[model samples]
Target: MTDPITIQWTPKTGLPRRLTFEPLEKGYRRIEREWNGSEWRHCGSEHTTDLTLHPPEDPPTLEELISQIHGTWDHPNPAVLTFTNEDTVAEINGQLRYRSPTQDGWYAVTKTDLESHLRTAGYPTIHRLSETPYNRADFTADSIPRQ
Candidate 1:
């Protein structure tokens, strides 16, 4: 069974949109939404499972980077925050994950909720990622402040 995929696109000059795909029997159903000044409105849906509709060409959203921080364990817990730009998607322990370093499962939340939580936690985040190509999961913890 394929997991539900959420691809976020924050363009350089416009509002961002996040498309989530729920896998079905043969294909998938997608909910396309765009921010319309106040909130996200349903742009449309599709019968096909073509992921190309929300390609990973865009940069990682702040939410995606925050999820990585959620999985980032400092010492005792396993270091789960690994980076990969495979297919242009900056994924960490797979995208759209809600589990923290010590959690069992997940607790899904809305984008607004996520933003609030991350802000409250105050985990130092890297504002920019290097465009330089690398072979492995080459992310560093430089954004984290020293104790």
Candidate 2:
């Protein structure tokens, strides 16, 4: 068994991040991202059955990094779009229709796109919008008008 790999990333904003890659059962690999908070909050995880760790003899290059960041465009799945409002959706369908995550205030992405984005952004997984329907009645107690 090989030792786990650890990588540290310090973003300009928010908190520092740590990434760990560990070998898993059945020749699978697990990659986890955690925020270096007071409590070590978990950000996400990724599982791959065919992950290989390369030695320092061939380190990743800047082009590879850039490719990893922008390669989502070649994904087979269509991207999803999350809009803040109907207007934003309409605007996205109008001008920036080709682009996911509308320019105004929306996030659009397909699963592959999301995955690529997460991987490139150093996030293990991407959070999807809640599919469960929300109702006003469910929030009756918490619903208070702002004065």
Candidate 3:
């Protein structure tokens, strides 16, 4: 097996950031990040040992991982700017209306927006649920009842 992938970033200021990607059971991989700070503080995912891993195969590239860390993950939220697939720039009646779905009716978000809502929620890192390992039919009939 290959050694865990480690990425290091040194900003102009502040401590350096290091990310380590480790393989997990069931063909999954987990990522852990630490800030080169006093006592080597961890930046996110408090439960170090319990941190879930990402799948080993098809792991996100370094650029993708950096984007995610920089608050540009694919998930959408109103606080951050996000563009959806249906967004278009058009002059409607001469007034520019950047419109799309709003989180709380306060603002609009496009389908193609690329901002992270994690900061707004006060989280150092954002996590999203991966696709289920099995489909509903894969389970026994008695395992789950119809809603």
Candidate 2: list runs displaced more than 4 Å: 53-147
| Native-referenced Cα lDDT, model 2 | 0.39
- For residues 1-147, could you state the per-residue lDDT of candidate 2 as single tens digits? 667777888779767777777767655455556565565577777665545565446544433433333423223321222222211111112221112222322333334543454433432211121321222122122322323
- Candidates' lDDT values, in order? 0.49, 0.39, 0.34
Question: What lDDT tens digits, residue by residue, belong to model 1 across residues 48-100?
Answer: 64455557687567666656545433323222322222111123443333333
- Name the runs in model 1 displaced over 4 angstroms: 50-147
Candidate 1: lDDT over CA atoms? 0.49
Q: Compared with the true structure, what per-residue lDDT tens digits does model 3 show for residues 57-118?
A: 76444335334434322233211112222221211222212222321112222222223432
Best by TM-score: 2
1 versus 3: better TM-score goes to: 1
Structure candidate 2, residue pairs in collision? 79-109, 79-110, 80-109, 80-110, 81-108, 101-108
